[model samples]
Target: MTRSLLDPSAVPAELRPYLAELVQRVGILCGPHLLSVFAVGSIALGDYRHGRSDIDVNVVVEPSLPGEVVRELAESLADGALRCPAAGLELVVYDSAFVGRPSDQAGYLLDLNTGPLLPERVSFDPAAAPAFWYVLDRSIAYQSERVLYGRPVRHVLAAPSQRHLLAALMASVREHTTGIGHLPDNQVLNGCRSVAFCRTGRWAAKREAAQIISESEPDFRPLLETAVRSFERPRTAALELPATEVRTFLAWVRERVEEAAESRL
Candidate 1:
């Protein structure tokens, strides 16, 4: 029998039921091969917003688990079937081998996206995913994941090296600068979080990082403030930040990240 490590009380009250169902379904689908299920992102960081945040879950399974089981698991937990109560469910499944020796690049067996705010996606190919995001997310998970079942996070999740993290941060900055139709709030907050991680080598929640940055960089406070406010609003109610200001903020962040990366060499 797998040792259960879930603490229902640690989860937000409203999300508890959904999480319970999710864990139960996943256990049923993956059977004895399921190693662990845990929460990351906003929920793990204590910054979850009932109507605005997605539940980001990471699951680990034995290497021998069949691909068909993985596909069935994804289909069962998809938006229509599981009916995500939050913005959506962003779940990634990894075999124990990958978890034991995680790559700096993408190594997920499945990347499942579901929810009203997110475009539904079920990706099985690592090459199809952006590697930087996975690296950064794993870094964050190492620092603050909440295990819902199976073994402790530290036993299964490796902390990404500062070099890999900085690389990932730089890649994210490049994406923001060149990407089209980006979410303005995400742009600003991501910059704030990246700068925080670069300087402190610690992961802070999006708004927490923004608040810390706002004090030291008063010039960007208004932009950060606007982004935080917009981020807290329901998706339908959020307002867009000015494009020029967002570009400027991102440029500043790019400089900081580049400086941080250079200083280490």
Candidate 2:
């Protein structure tokens, strides 16, 4: 399993130490809550485009939401890193937690889009891969790393469905491409490949996506673009798909996602 803490050594001379530190600090604050926070958007998905992705984190808070926790979150938001949005602080907050059954082969993302006001303990997955959807239910693992503060962050699995993850991603891609009516071929193919692997049990998708990403040095600009497309193609509501093919699709999509995620570091 990939540890939530990434190796900052290979990061670009300019961004290596900086982003390495940022992800690490994110871990610290998240660790106390028994939550795992990971760079998702352009950074983690390896599809960043310029000015497209700000630091985005996919967080799953543990235990449950307590009113007192909300107050602590307010202070945490005082820091500039936290961004305010309909989701209260879109950037990061302990109040909002992603619920997923790490053991399930099929899952879908659920986030408190309304705000950090997590009145309930619900499940959410905040990841994007336009062409396809995937479920890393078994692959999901928890790892710890250092953050800005003298603290560490622990990552836990926030499993989501392979189909749902892909559909929302395609919607995002089409939105950004000005192809609102249709999704980009690359997004569909790549995502299809991803979904194929995740839904079914194909091993080829991982290698293929990695090959494309490996050919070039990891860069966040492209990943950011993907993130923008994802944001644009936001789903009006969750769409359902048969869970049968999940293993195969996820296999392919994971390859591409990892390729782009490499750039995030």
Most TM-score-accurate candidate: 1
* Residue 248 in model 1: lDDT: 93
- Highest lDDT against the true fold, candidate: 1
lDDT (Cα atoms) of all candidates against the true structure = 0.87, 0.36
Q: For candidate 2, what is the lDDT?
A: 0.36
lDDT agreement of model 1 with the native? 0.87
Quote each prediction's TM-score: 0.95, 0.37
* Clash counts for the predictions, in order: 0, 72
Instruction: List, residue by residue over 1-31, the lDDT tens digit for candidate 1.
Output: 3343389987898889889888988888888
lDDT (tens digit, per residue) of candidate 2 on 148-252: 232223334433344444443443333333424332323333444343343343323322443443344244224423422443433332222223232233343
Q: Give residue 134's error in model 1 in angstroms.
A: 1.0
